[model samples]
Target: MNRLFDKSIVLACCIAAAVGLAVDARLVAAFCLGVIATSLAEVAQGNRARRASETASYVYIIAAVFVPPFVPLAPLAFYDIARRVRREHAWVALGIGSVFAFALIADLRTDALTARTLLLTAILSVAATLLSLRTAQLEREQQRMRRTRDELQERALALEARNRDLADRQDYEVELATLAERARIAREIHDNVGHQLTRASLQTEALRVVHANEPRIAADFADVKRTVDEALQLVRASVHALNDNAVDLSVQLDCIVEGARSDGGPQVELEALAEHAPANVANCFAAVLREALSNAMRHAHAKTITVRCMEHPSFYQLIVTDDGADATPASSSNVAEGMGLASMRERVEALGGTFTAGPRVGAGGWRVFATVPKPQGDEDR
Candidate 1:
């Protein structure tokens, strides 16, 4: 848009100079040619192109001196130069206008210079200078507006990036809090409900043993023990649901085995093959492993323990074996199991699994084996 407007101004100046030269002498026509060339040069160069174009406007002012009719074109050239130059160099345009005024005054061939002629020249020169200064002011205002727009765009981009980062951090904090809450609930169930049920099972088992001679009383005690075992299984399932299994099952098993070894217990080894399991399944397995290891280390006086995990087509299995004294003979007969074994059994069975713990039939050690069916849809994955 600016380019087209500049070209129009240059064309108008050329037409005016051509008409003026046609009515004047040949010498005046030749001088007007110089004015046309300088004006064209000023128009051809862009605002930010080079400093060489600035000199063309000064040359135009000199050309206008020899031809009075071309003086009107001087203000246009001055305005162009002012728009391009800095405010500190603004005096250059006014100085060129002053030179044009002096040349006009001196060019009068009359014996005496009239006040009317002098005043007219001064007014024309002052108008051209003021026009150029106004152009320079508008240019400065435009530059300031452009700078402000660029700054606002950059600030908007920075603010958008900051908002995205803040949103991501907020989501992370919420997830951490949720996981912490789930872990707390799991701990509460284990420490409270699990402990109370374990004690009840033990007492019920003791009552069964004391009433063994009375068949009816023993059967009633057995029924009570069965009810307690069922309640324990439900509590374990709830605990397993509350636990978040973000950690891999294999990593958790390794930590458990390492902890037993660090405590100066029997030499413990773990071999976990199943990499992915449902959260509830993994939690039940962890509980069973912890209880089995404790029983082997504390009651059986095992010298070494081996923990192995296997993945089947429809189920996952965990086996913990220890080179320890035989399991209590009563464990095979269902004649009142200990708290550790009973708790392990309940946890595994609660997840629709089978659990067995006793002395390995031809071996001199105890082995606890559990097999839980994979959740629907997880068996294939």
Candidate 2:
């Protein structure tokens, strides 16, 4: 039964017992019948021991009925004893039966039988009390196990959440690393190979310009060929330096300006503030500066460009200012226009630095400023 039904049944049995006792009727017998019926129902509902022990319980009550003037009390004692026994306690049930039989055969007026019944009742009561204590202990253990299970379930859920969080963080870190590597490789390509190619293209254009009217003068063509060969050798040296992962930024900048001027790219001025600049830092800044200058000449139509490098205590700054025709003169586009600025931003920011490009206030074209940290050993390159 549900809790309410079980409670009501017990309450009804107690009330019946009280009324039967007041009216001098078979009160304990009625109570035993109720307990037996309920216990049997519990067993039929799959509570096995409840119904099985209840049979012995009912027999004990019938025996008690023939025995004493206070016979109802015998069933109450049997109900308590039945609640205590496991299947192996059949001997206890037989002992209860024998006590009830002896009580019935001996007369009530005999002092010996009265004393014996009293002693037997006391022993059964003690056994019931001990079994009740053991049941209480088992109940407490079950409660303890239930609480432990709840705690473990909570911890398991928390650990799962933590693992998910860690996994997400790792994925984000991986993506960031990939983007940084791309930026580094881009900077390498622009500052090294791109500069050399631009120089070669400039010399070829210059040779073509100088020999425009001397189509038949083969000696002047040979002189142009020698200059072309020297430029090629210098380009080769720069390429070699890149393979070794180091290059002189000053030399690279000279080559870039010379090539741009020769090809009529722009009138570009370059400067450096480092008494001892690191090769790696130089290479990165050179890449950024070259891209800026290329953007000014190709798109902005900048005429006079000044590229300045300034050294600070912890960081170095490269500033490229151009006096060029603005792409959007009416209401101009800012640094967000194309991949050139985007690439410059990515290169600087990935190295834990800042990049800002905008129109120079009032005077003319665009300004790009990139600040990069100088590592410890790079103070003198």
Candidate 3:
């Protein structure tokens, strides 16, 4: 549609030129000038002084109508002047209106063939100019809408970022609270249950001494054993709290037993003789002991598993051996297989130590033994 309108406008300019050449040049030129001035006034008002320009626009338009013909290019000259003045529709309206006025002036002369041409051209130009203006207005509106859409999209992205930040903060808070709760529970178990277990164990030892020959005195020992069992359970339940983000040998051993029990395996015996051990040696031995026991219970199907933790001046050795009364569920000899033995090896070796696990030499059994290097400062302690 725009192409058709532009073509029509060009054709109108051709006809107006022809008419101006044929008619009285002075009259046509004056009329063209008037048309240019009117268009300039109207165009200038597009974003400027509207009321005053509008009134001037009417005056110029009337003058264009009253002027004579033969002013073929006069309207374009006036349009150029308006362009220099930075008016909006000046050049465009002058292109169409000047020709229109010339056409009307030519119609008054019945003998002039040029007048007929100008009249026809003027009609086409007017139609084309109106169409062009309407299209331009539509384009402006579309541009505005697109800008608004872009702004909305940016706002949405910002909102999404803010929501993600809030979610991350919430997750952090939850993790912090969980850690805090674990710490509190661990303290409770150690202070309350641990003390009670120590007292009960002492009492049981005392009773066994007093009733050394009496078979019935076993009952008193059993009562103390029950108390120790309860203490262990309490410790297990709150062990995560006790972990201080560092090695806790006792808790580590208990965890291993718990995991083995969950797998429906045989029971385990953990023997820790820390009375002659340094604190570091005690902790590392406990870790190795648990790993050894876990492997025995899970892979060896041992009826009786024993973890013996012993410490020396330079290092600590954890000896875990089991009676292989029951064959392992898996028969493959992949020493580095499902047994947590490899992971245990890595842990001990990382601390500058050695670890070994394999079938026992004497009988149907499996054993895991590890030696952990002692820290320099821990040797004195």
The pairs that clash in candidate 2 are: 302-324
Range of the 10 consecutive residues with the lowest summed lDDT in candidate 3: 77-86
Better of 1 and 3 by TM-score: 1
Which lDDT values do the candidates have, in the order given?
A: 0.69, 0.60, 0.56
Flag regions of model 3 displaced more than 4 Å. 1-113, 206-230, 233-237, 241-381
Summarize candidate 1's per-residue lDDT along 230-253 as a digit string, tens digits: 999998998887784544779867
- Output the TM-score of candidate 3: 0.37
Model 1, 373: alpha-carbon shift in Å?
Answer: 30
Clashing pairs in 3: 28-69, 28-70, 28-71, 29-71, 43-88, 43-89
lDDT of 2 by residue, 1-381 (tens): 232343353344335334323333444554555455545534554456655655655564565546343443443445445444566876866677666656655534564334454554445444443444455566668889998887786566445434544553465466456556655665676587667666766766677677778766545655666776677667566545444433455666667666667465577887866544554566567667766776787668887989788778888888989998655221122334555566567768867889988788888798899898877665553
In candidate 1, which residue pairs get closer than 3 Å at backbone N, Cα or C atoms, i.e. clash?
Answer: none
Q: What TM-score does candidate 2 get on C-alpha atoms?
A: 0.33
| Candidate with maximal TM-score | 1
